[model samples]
Target: MSAAPPEEEEELALPRRPPPCHAVCSSRAFATLYSLVTYALVPAGVVALIEVRYAYLLLFVAQLLLAVGAVEWSWLAFRIRQRLLLAVSLHEDGPPQPQEPTEDAPDSSEHPPPPSSDVNQSEEQTEAAAARRAHALEDQPLRREDPRESYARLMAEAMRAKSFAIAPLADWLFCGQWYLAAFVLASLGAAASVALGYAVESSVFGSANPAAGWRMMVGASVEAAFVSIFCSSLAPSGADSVVLVVYQACVLVASMNAYLKLHVDVIASDSQVDPLFIILAGAIVIIVFRVVTSKVVMQSLLLVLCDVLGLVCIVSPLIAFADLIDQPMGHSFRNQFALFVLVVVATDVGDCLAKELQRHWPQVFQWCRHPLLKSEATTKDVEALAISLACGAIMIVVVRLGSGVSAFNAVEVIVLLCAMALGQWCRLWMAHVRQMAKVTTSAFYLSEGSRAGGVLDRMAVFLVAIIVYYPYIKQKYFSSS
Candidate 1:
């Protein structure tokens, strides 16, 4: 085996520097702590919230944040919806303007200069060149954007961001109708989750197969629906008989969708039309119907019953679409899975910060002089070990919270750490060994870098957890219904 070129090591050692916002805020250790703390807001962790005393306190904190952020959320969502509507309208208006002629193309003219009789076509080539230059000159006004436009774009982006990260809890606290909340939640919450995962991917693994942000958004929206349903199904309430049926139905419906996704081909369409917005539209229709029906001189209990049934109906089709899209659809109930997702975002952000700190300022970790830490390939190897450790810890915590501590649970955590660590070590070790020999023409590295991307991390953690906890999961959640 031949050694990889020096460029491979250089790439690993020097990633693109993060944005200034990240450097000052999310990169800090405090941000990692904040990430874990936000998990309390994830209503999907009801299994823990109901059982753990600490979680009860966290519930209050989560509630407080959500309630306070609603005003901000309302404003942000309104702006985003306006943008979405306008953008969609313009997109449907007409075919996009034709691209400017390139230098290689024929001259653009109503009447072309007769194809030059010369066989070499020198005159034709010159005319084409002149025409291309003219086209470029004409494009300058549209291409050269104004500074104010850039500022407005940035501000719009900032607003879109706030809509996703903030806002939730005290479902009744928001000013909008139920469907309005659902629409914004579906759009911003689902889109935010997708965006966070994408944000980490580039630094960790730049590859030939570029990630598709739109497909990811569609999928994340699907997962959002399922996760929310899972969390909502676990909501605690003191109810007798028939009311228990509502909660029971919620759990059954959720698990049913999970199975359908795993086993059935459910989604009828795979075109570019985003089913998420369509699902939200469906919810809106249902909500509007319920609202209009309430105006009649009917009993309040009947009205409440209709509202609950309408809510259930809305989620049913959303889950069904999720099964077919091979994507996650969440939102409508952002509190459920929204904050739990920060675990990935935080870990990725923190991991990059650590590497950045080590590469640029090794003195920060100089206090720890362990033998293993002394490797020449310090930056990349350490990053791999960090991923293995981080993945192991998150799995342990999440699994334990979902299913209390057990003998098998201990073994499961150990096995996962062993698998992840060995995988990371073997990959890095082989890359290092390969770098010594210069065996191949191509650059040899385990992946683009050792730092983990949040999207990959979440996928890896969940995949491992499913395999390790399949039996327990089947017995506890699936069979419970």
Candidate 2:
């Protein structure tokens, strides 16, 4: 490429300046207090609660701060909603009123004396001037604005934002609901297990000298459920839920063995001495479930399940890497955590690619009719599929070679990523709807020759998204890394 002009290069090379608010904050007491509360007190309290015996006091303070934060967030949301509503209402109201004619003007009945040759010529010039004045006056208001136009603009924006929230709900009805159900069930099951464990351990088992039976029942139930939920959410197909249920039951039985070992005061060091046999048995059951389910059920659920699993796969690695950076080695805790994230991402990508590949024929037809659809397809689809397959194959090889690898964290990350994607999708739909409405209103107003006003309003959105969110994302995700 040719080198850019000096002036253009100079413009591009401009340095970033701190935001006005950032500078103002350094000068203001209230802003400083706000910073202290959010950045200092809140985090300190949370950490103190986690690592200290006097944590209850900090926890109480944290809760109070949280209450204040919630109120502030709610208020901000309310204000935004209100402004949006008002803007919509105002658009529907139309433009400003036109100015009326003045009462203090010369009457048509007034007549001057009969003009000679020179007087007639002067009168003709005067009449032409008056005509031009009237024309200029007529165009002035059109150049300014009609208040009604503003109302129409707001109406369009309101409609768009409204539709964005609507479309996702409709889309979710067909595809997202089952995944939603699974997520809810897993979370609920976890909550129930925690509650039950706490209740039984505190009340039935007694902290001073708990009954082995009750403690085993509570601990086993909680741990098993955790494993089950984690496994099912990660699985591409099979009786995922059923597998989890079985795992929980088997673990319950194994808890008796654990209690016996504890009673004997056994301190066996090898992996074989651990109660991991129950976990191994659960995996075997899942493998069996996968085989049986393949033969019995239609594989539609597998596709959706895989997609959900894959999404978690992609995000998990990043989180694990983040964790690994924080964690020290020697007692290197679950290095596979990051790898699992990769696997989840890979699986999700694979699932998506497989589906996309399957739809290639249909996509071809779609592209024939909708050129834009073709343009939107990117390498991401292909890359994700390849990664997923690679992760799965690698896991298989690792298993065969007897190398250690954990896919759980990867699975969790992918799932959470899917949830995040869903949230973003919803937001995107809403934004698109709002833009369309705004553009339509702008177009209608522009038809009457309102160029500067229309462009200003249209450009504001692009500026905000680019100037705000893009930088925020870069800072959050890429800056440190």
251: Cα error in model 1, Å: 9.8
Q: Per-residue lDDT for 49-158 in model 1, tens only?
A: 33432221232222222222222222222343344444454456743343342333444584355465764766676677777667655543333344455444433443
On the 0 to 100 scale, the lDDT of residue 471 in model 2 is: 32
Q: Estimate each model's TM-score.
A: 0.26, 0.26
Indicate the residue-level lDDT of 368 in model 2: 31
Candidate 2: tens digits of C-alpha lDDT, residues 1-481: 2345333355457543321122433344644564465434644444443333332122123222222222222222222343455654445664335344332333335534335757766777568657756665553433323456544444433332221111233246636333354455557776798787676555434444546446445554555555455434422223434543553354344433433233322223242233345545545555555556565232323422332232122112212222222222202222232233233333433443444654564453343344445544344344333444554556445543464545334444344344333322332333343343333222121222212212112222222222222233334333454
- What is the Å distance of residue 310 in model 1 from its true position? 16
